[model samples]
Target: MTPISSKGRTRGGLAALICGALAAGGLAAAGTTALTPQAAHASSHREAPLISGTPQYDNTDLYAFVSPDRPDTTTIVADWIPFEEPAGGPNFYPFAEDAQYDLHIDNNGDAHGELLFRYTFKTHVRNKHTFLYNTGPVDSLDDPDLNVTQTYDIELIRLKNQHVMSKTKIADDVPVAPSNVGKASMPDYGKLRDQAVHQLPNGAVTFAGQADDPFFLDLRVFDLLYGGNLSEVGNDTLKGYNVNSIALQVPTHLLTESAHQPVVGIWSTTQRRTAHGSYAQVSRLGNPLVNEVVNPQKDKDTFNASSPWQDARFLKNVTNPELPRLIESIYKIKAPAEPRNDLVDVFLKGVPGLNQPPHVTPAEELRLNTSVKPSMHPKRLGVLDGDTAGFPNGRRLTDDVVDAALQVVEGELVGSKNDLGDAVDANDKEFGHTFPYLAEPTEGSRGPLAKGTSGGTDVRSQLGDALQPAGESRNTTLIAASAASGAAGVLLIGTGLAWWRRRVRRPY
Candidate 1:
């Protein structure tokens, strides 16, 4: 298999036509009920209905790859609900212990293959106190009435030859350790961010807690263009927002089949209590909130019930390499040559481009080429930017996946000289640079900006004027005009120029 390099940009014109086709044909039929082909294969965002209400279990996207921070380990990031608040608590969120989190592999190249590793969370909450407020300014040194403490457990499982084995327990009802549990017994922003990091054995680490959601997009623009109105764009506005996150980093050797064959596929699942009132009934499974495959409100439960168990029949319809011809037949547009072949070949052999005939199986899991070295300077631009860590490998929290999908649809990666015309700003804001991998939330009611001191009414205007685009500095003109001339020469030249211009334009 040829290793795919991440370095190409979408050609403009043809790119636009493909996007037009996708918009007109793919998304035109999208809604709460049915999904179009173009939208089916795109990154999963707002894809399933069950997660619409429960953001934590939504599983909007999943990412897996060799860790750039530590190549010996593999890193997996699971994102839910687009822009969750990083600091929206007194009531912080945690992953459900009963939920079964999985990372699947397909070494055979077939979409349906063997299971690899699975993680289960077992939440153990103790001393559940209702309110956190107290009337007195000072309390007793050993006051049990101060607050309630929380904790949880996590189990890891590995599967081989269809047999399951419990690998290890990362954490047990270990104190739901507060960010600043010891320092002054009150919430401290700095300590909270720092305490979120959890170190594991053998150089592995895990951080699970509430953090700012890192996705930002002007959803209103797309909704207005396609959905006819932006009335439903509630807290979806992207000026500045965040989400709760759970991040894990583990040694790569533990996940790969062997160092010689480093490629692996990945996916995530969540189970909840169905109305049947049986805990044995794992009513929900599959990565929710993604797929962007429209589902009717009536079929929401159907979508959930069918996602994890029915992949061979339901998912293969769109994920199958043979489906593009079906797409062409349905949309009545000529399918581009290279991408049609690329999809078929890659789906079959795990090759990067359609450069080689497929030799792998057709599993519908995210595939990663472990032989490809982890990028020290990772780019969030996804496939279009030539980064393997983006889509087709595994999904990352910060990837600009919409652009990547548009590029693929327009055949940009296949050396096609056509542009996709889906040019949107590429430098949108992203998450931070460390564990939990999200930025800290700014405090106070003002949000991104705080109120001014001294009743300065013009602060907003002054701030706006200073925030200009790159290269045009405020003192550029003054420095350019005065640098070459001596101090007296500058003054004399300025006066002379002013007088000459005034004389020539007087009454003219």
Candidate 2:
């Protein structure tokens, strides 16, 4: 994306430049936390030391947007359990039974959630006598063969200034989409996903299940900030990985203060059950990279636990960001002057006349103005590309947030205009067009290249090559082959988790 040139307007003072910059297209950048060895990995994926160890309770990315197909509704997607290897099984990933996943809406710009959607999951195991996850080929969510399953309950809670005024169970016993085990087991995975989607009594649609990790970016920046020469770029780090996702689509009027006030702030949090049986908020995500790149080590965990209204302590991170300064030191590009109030406004509050609500509380949130209709031809760079319908208006599945945020972090807003990007522009997989828009989770059958079948081999052929020995009878070898595959998958999981922990522990 090219920079917005100064053709009609003169480069006046910083204030004028800020106003002009915000008016044309708002800044999508926000203050970031300490860069870990896993820096630039999927936004908010394993961002903190404590949360990194608890993937199921970790908040990966949050997306909120006016539904492109049905403009009358807004879709909010929050992902957890980052980097889920499709093959990691026996006991595949499941929503933490003891945790409470919540989606919060600040409709009045008060930085406090006026409404919250709390999701609690329960696991079901029909055949404890067998080691199999499924007894036979599964065709539907309620298929008898599916021995292990999960169901969740959704509670709609109304609060005034954080104190709950009302709580109602909107959905109960909603089936969660099971993991896409290989084709033989879950022959029609798509059908299972469709069955998992549930319609709530409040005219809302909800889905909870495994989906492809939609966040894409060049995560190799951890290697001395792109090999310290921009050499390590363009690779989508999150490709092939899956995440457990919770998607909700609610009527537009329900999220806003009123028809007149369409702007609303959105965020998600994961609360784990403590030893005392009290649920404690362990993970929170709003904007894509706020906790990943803005907060320091000392404050990363604190940021996760704190509420939006109590964000005053982290204000310095926004006003005087470290990312630009690091870029300046490494690349010799001059950093923007200190005290970046423009960042504070756009990221914490929202862009005025765009998505910013009147009487904003200046807290970090994915603020969306439902009044702005969906774009027919969405620009990946989002608002920076003059497509106000995308982020930072509210993040869309297709928004190139890494590029837009990079450009802004390099001082695009304060007149140092240029394009800076991670080069990885879009998600490796195409997102769905329906209610739960995330792409289907990668199936467990995927395997690495073998000696002869290396080029463009289809998955079925690969599976056959992996399972059937030369001239071996199908029935005789299938059981042994499947056992071997399961063992390999378990080994893969162990190695992957160890590698990830090492990376997470590395100092920035």
Candidate 3:
């Protein structure tokens, strides 16, 4: 794990980065308010009506960034099964045997994967008679008494100009690390986490097992979209949760076709084998919070079922998005004009100067510039605050994407400023600065978690309050520094009040 050092990032960047480190270290922070449901996050975590039925195969989050340690390599992480309680005993979470898990990469901007990494898991129970996951203590991954064990195979396929050119098996019969049941069952979880990190057949590194849910958000965004005050972020609902993660560190040459264009698009998909032999796409994730909040209900299932190239049908949602409209109506602030090309530039196609490839079709996928040297002092409000090495390019674990995303939707990239946001700038857990950056999963017999509001206020709040409420006595304290935030406060209350008035009708 990369050591936590001074990273002179944007205003509140250093603090958020520390939060990420704490999240990775299994730390916690408590607040007066309760941990609401994680309202703000990326990808589809039971977002679709159909995928919601299958949690194991659902892609909860996807993260890809240039390896900070190895500049020549890039690490891609895809997580599944949202909000998994650590204490889920007996039949713990495991990758679906019948499902095909794949990491898709597109180098030329065609929205087609030029290279694909596939994984298929198999479960083995040594002793069917034993009800315990382990008959005794699990000192090692290969413990004989370990009743149930899960393993997988790694297959890499490369396509040049839309035709498969080569296929190779990087590994076979790789054993997965056992779950962190408790102190009695698995005393040393660090060993399990380390043993799970295996060297791939092709020289790449990979790890597949349970880990802490790194994605953090103040769920208070639910009840009313804009009611909660931004002073203190609510508890991280995902702090005590875990997720099934697939982390891979591979070379850049495997993804790109030419050295001229260093940009590549990434996305993950889950497929279930059909009787016909081919796999049917079930779940997909590229960018964070896309299906969760961007798309409407009627189109969510379709978005998950379709491929990136098929995203054209949903382009209407991007050009004139509904989210901005909600922000405008509720915040009572002006949003970017219709035919919002600014959004299309960021959401669909990668920003031209930052991550867009020289020649490519506009599509929805996480675009990363492999050329950008990983920044140690990465900012949470990526791109918005001049931190080009962070998100909106390729998301890093420490990136404060929630705030960045909010600022982007409010036209921050185009120079419009709206600092109002969920005060939760940092994640509940710390993030590692290396491969398999996620922190350890909450143990089954995990001790009671600790919480603290020891950190200072998030920058968005401080910036909004930079100019203290005018001394002049007025009905409403006008925050001159951040006029938008003052109006945002009123708008949020009004929206919450309006919802109360319409109690008779079901709110969408």
Candidate 4:
């Protein structure tokens, strides 16, 4: 077991205090600005054209933070399969068996991974003929009634300048928590989730399964940037949806280069098996909104498949971001002057003196100083709010990255610090405080379901009978007809909405 010690606060605290001082003054001034760009923000969710069609392989978000409860370790959580509907039955979400989900670590400043954790999944079905996801209540991971189950293997690979130096299968046959298939099927999803949290022989903790999508932001930004007048602000579009997550908590010593070098850069990637039976990297995510806000349409998919070492190609995108120009066009705000080195420091390279590595390569990564202790009371605005323990240092679930990124993109670091946001401040569900700290997945039975549906209630009705028979009272028949018409109208609206969503490139 690693020794418990509070480390790096002297440097981290002083740096945070200085950032805090600047944020305090700038935030207060920014408060009075009339232009709040709520529509100009979103995280990585179906951000690219190709990934939108393949939710199973799309890497939605990646979070890395020093364990708040157990500071001796760092926990990294990578989520996939964005926007899972709770009631989607028959076949709920599962980690793709033909894909490789990876978490990459760059301990030195070489812009390439020195360590890589690869996860591969395999699904099992108890009954081949059965269409049901579960035959009966799944009280445990090994329940015989659970027809469809998933297990995964994790491999730890040591790399030297992207060359594999060693490969070891750290854990295998670990149960993945099943989807929350309503109360009737999974009576205690929480218990099942706990059971999936396996403690490995190497003092690492691993969990893989469905959890509430922790990234929060007004995705309505795509709706004409919040209806152009900010009418679509303040609502968390991702509320109630779920995502398949793979989490790992390892000893702090394992991630650092040495005691003298405490900084580490992390990112996640997904490689899908191609038709030739070879895997091709399809999706990559590190810092939030990089592909969505920083990269343009032509290069969106390109960035996803690229390695950090080759990030110099995308450097111009950061220095001259389209987000600020778009903001300038819609609102009257002046875009930050070009060759924006401020953004280069904050996004491409980690902020100097805070999370930046010594002699670092300019590349994208969720850089974290593992020695920085978790904040007792973490601020949502993250480093901008002076809470260096949060985002940009490495994202905690509670960090309000949408607001933080908006302000930073709008020149918060270059002295123009104002709170420009999507108006959605926090996650709709509260996150847990344990090893796998995401909120419980929203159950299919977690109600306000269809109008008359209730637990075990029969919803079957005679087709068109509710419209009233010809012999019924004239007034009653007329009223029934009116009700049926209203129902039909609602159905049409819903159908049209679905079609419209499909038409958009980044619907989720």
Best by lDDT: 2
Ranking by TM-score: 2, 4, 3, 1
Q: Rank the candidates by lDDT, best first.
A: 2, 4, 3, 1
1 or 4, greater by lDDT: 4
Candidate 3 Cα misplacement greater than 4 A, ranges: 1-42, 160-163, 226-233, 275-277, 447-508
Candidate 4 Cα lDDT to native: 0.79
Q: Give lDDT tens digits, candidate 3, residues 1-508.
A: 0111224534443223323433453221111011221111237667789889989999998989888888788899999998788778898888899998999899888677889999989999998886788888888888886778899998898976558989988879887876678777888887878888998744589999998988887655554454522333445656788999999999877777677788999999889988998888888888988887787888787777777766766666666778777766655668877665566667666765678776556667899988888886776777656677788788888776676777667665454645645656677778776678888888887643312243332334334323335774221222332244444664455455455757846766
lDDT of 4 by residue, 190-214 (tens): 9999999999866889999999999
Error of 4 at 455 (Å): 15
lDDT (Cα, tens digit) per residue for candidate 1, span 1-508: 0112234553333234334434454322221112212111112344455456665555555656566656676677665444544344444454555455444544434333254344444443334555442212213312353353334455666554445644667665533323222223443545555555667777777755444444443354244322333233223344344443456777777666666666765555555544574432122322222244323344444544443223333323333333224335543434556324333223222334311113443333466766667556556554445555554455555665444443354355344433322233332445555555555543323332234444333332333224445675534432344443335554455556556857887986
Error of 2 at 170 (Å): 0.4
What number of clashing residue pairs does each candidate have, in the order they appear? 45, 7, 17, 0
Query: How much lDDT does each candidate structure score?
Result: 0.44, 0.81, 0.73, 0.79
TM-score of 4: 0.82
Residue 437 deviation, candidate 3, in Å? Answer: 1.5
TM-score against native, each model: 0.62, 0.84, 0.78, 0.82
10 residues in a row with least lDDT, candidate 2: 33-42
